[model samples]
Target chain A: MEKKDGCVKPSKGVIQTEETKSAAEPVQNGKETQKMLAKVGKPAPDFELSAFFEGGFKNVRLSDHKGKWIVVCFYPGDFTFV
Target chain B: MGVEVVAISTDSRFSHKIWQEEELSKMVDGGVPFPLLSDAGGRVGTVYGVYDEDAGVDIRGRFIIDPDFNIRAMEVLTPEVGRNVSELIRQVKAFQHVVETGEVTPSGWQPGKPTLTPGPDLAGKVWKEWKPEMAFD
Candidate 1:
């Protein structure tokens, strides 16, 4: 079982839901997901996050690609589920 | 015609770098065509609804955004399921075609395939507009 701690190593492509959705509310748990994002057919939420660049790190933002098509994918983690 | 592919995760940039160097070398022939954004604190993932609080990781999610920053298409998959890159490419191409030509592709549409224009007269005869060919796999 992968603990909810950020320090623990992740296994490849292993998926586990939360023990209780109640615990994740306000507290946030990785098991239960809330499908409430107002994204489809609307504007995407603009976000700026760090990214692995050419042998370095760079901040990437959603608004940066305003003039181009953007394919945004969110995977689990490195060396884990890709 | 221009598309920017950005991947994100809760992992730190250092972890992403190491993973790219060690594991992705074999999988990616030349290199990663796009930048892998690091959502280190899971803020972006939470907004995108792909964040899992239990495992402290993100589920597989794909969003196709157009040039005007509009969300054209999005898919959220379970952690166990892998995404189809070929299908994504096809969808991107489809979106591009529609934007350029104002025509919509039918089911199983691929490049060079016939498309449908939305109209009442062309509605019932959609079968006549598109002919199936054994081109796309």
Candidate 2:
């Protein structure tokens, strides 16, 4: 969503977990999948990820970004590798 | 033509805040253009196929989704390589142009350049109508 200053801000959340080992899998139609998707022609799996925005936390859903192009980037560590 | 950029990492929101404050202070406005997502559980990272389980970190995975939520473009890369923002911007512009005008942008297409109208007649004659000299930088 665009902020009052006209700059589009990102939404994020924070929830630490003990588990770290998992495989990447493809998501089913509209369902969350842990695997990598096969191709880029299908609809993206719907998901809600918590985001950090404006010094606060909120839930950001993929479906909420409909009607506008969305760029989802997954990067490595924030402090170490980023 | 509105586009939103979201990034996910295996760091907590607290870490994101630190990066924004300490390291990313030189950003355009003192922070990233978009929000840095906190994929604390590694759920989003794993789903997008960028996480390295052995390192407890993610590789570089980028996806461009159209307005209808279609996966228009995606690139999964190793952490050693970084993404190119200029190329990504070009692609977003190209995709939006097609969605709006129903015309396909040829290779090396930038804004305000020539576009090709896909049709049966143009099937094997794209080079005839579009010459490389006609391209706009």
Tell me, by lDDT, which candidate is best. 1
List-wise, what DockQ does each model earn?
Answer: 0.39, 0.47
Q: Model 1: which docking level applies?
A: acceptable
Which parts of model 1 are misplaced by more than 4 Å? A1-38, B130-137
lDDT of 2 at B131: 84
lDDT per residue (tens digit) for residues A1-82 in model 2: 5454312334442222222113333356877345554258777766666566666656677768888899988888776543
In model 2, how large is the Cα lDDT of residue B112? 78
lDDT of 1 by residue, A1-82 (tens): 5244344323222111342223234534645443335367777777677667777666666777898999999898778754
Clashes by residue pair, model 1: A18-A31, A29-B53, A29-B54, A30-B52, A30-B53, A30-B54
Tell me each candidate's i-RMS in Å: 4.1, 2.4
True contacts kept of each: 0.83, 0.82
